[model samples]
Target: MSSTLYAAGRAARQSGDLQGLIDAVPYARFLGIRSAAPESSALLQLPFREGLVGNPALPAIHGGVTAAFMENAALLCLLLRLDVLRMPKSVDFAIDYLRSGRPLTLYADAEISRVGSRVAHVSVRCWQDQVQQPIALARGHFLLEPAPESA
Candidate 1:
């Protein structure tokens, strides 16, 4: 990731393309996660691919992948909301698997429950077709560091 991408994220209100920020992250790019705008809301979308399947028999996406996706979503949400450009470090993370993620497009939305000077708390939910029936849910605390002052 680069500072240029963080600049893009800060400019998203004008450009309306948050996907650039998401794509800047290497893991998100590897997972084929992109940003989707449905109506007036932005969401993280994970497309179905063969390589993401952890169980060939059941053909389900790996649990770790889902967790990582949720965590990334939370991070992206925080990045977009902050005024400064800096990467957040995960202080703690907890996830609950509601159902197996089948071979289908998954979408996630993150909510920032609380934000302090040095820490932020977020909750994320992932679902296939309906948001009400989430396949996985995650909550995490992230350390937010201020950007170095320009010299």
Candidate 2:
């Protein structure tokens, strides 16, 4: 994992806003992310396949895909808090890889650092089998402007 994955997190730490980076999620995943408690943490699991693989020889999961997993996991915090009724959009996100993700099911964890009036922030971490070591980390920000009520 490259150290850059922690980019937003590091910045947020400096700015005292770890929650924004903790909330971004990818555009993939057939099943949405989940949380044990409304305020605990967001968790996501994605199975590896050629669809997620960029190169067949390396069989390494694409960095973008890994980022996506993190993003989905991070954004899940708000969804859980909102009870899946409100849909949040991905305004921006940042990822830092700690190492290369191997071919396997990935588990992602995210913590909400802050959920302000208009912005929800989160931090995400990814790992395969070992929870002790993280393969990548990410930070994301989501805008919470409600959409118009269509008749």
Candidate 3:
């Protein structure tokens, strides 16, 4: 599975196919995750679906779903931006729920703070209508496997 994903990642990177990369991940497809503007930025988007509602009364998105979306944003950013050959593994993730996620399309952007030899630190913010009013924020570390040098 990892090898397949690695090959897909390499293919996507070589062709600059952001949607293809998202399609390579089953879970991302299940969540309706897509690139907001792959040609410009690493912004990720999740279309609102009835199944995504956690609170029917309040019509709010599930917390777990929101977290997973943000995590995916970070992971996608790493895959799109870095020279990684193997899949990036989450080391630690911390999220702050600023507000309940409304039953609307969610947008997320991940910024890589630093990249060490083995780990990369990333921060992500999820919002609905307004970017200034974020619904959730997260910071995480991912274990990276750099591509081996050519002889």
Maximum-lDDT candidate: 3
All candidates' TM-scores? Answer: 0.90, 0.66, 0.91
Model 3 alpha-carbon drift over 4 Å, by segment:
11-15
Error of 2 at 117 (Å): 0.7
Worst 10 residues of 3 by lDDT: 1-10
Q: Which of 1 and 2 is the better model by lDDT?
A: 1
lDDT of each: 0.83, 0.63, 0.87
Candidate that beats the other on lDDT, 2 or 3, i.e. the better one = 3
Off by over 4 Å in 1: 38-40, 147-151
Quote the RMSD, in angstroms, for model 1: 2.2
Backbone clashes, candidate 2 = 27
Please tell me which model should have the higher TM-score, number 1 or number 3. Answer: 3
> What is candidate 1's lDDT per residue for 1-151, written digit by digit as tens?
5476567567764566777777777787788888878322458899988888999899899998899889989988887776546778899999999999999988999999998989999999999989999999999999987555670
Q: Residue 113 in candidate 3 has what lDDT?
A: 99
The candidate that wins on TM-score is 3
Q: How does candidate 2 fare on TM-score?
A: 0.66
Off by over 4 Å in 2: 1-41, 83-85, 146-151
lDDT of the structure predicted as candidate 3: 0.87
Give residue 98's lDDT in candidate 1 (0 to 100). Answer: 97
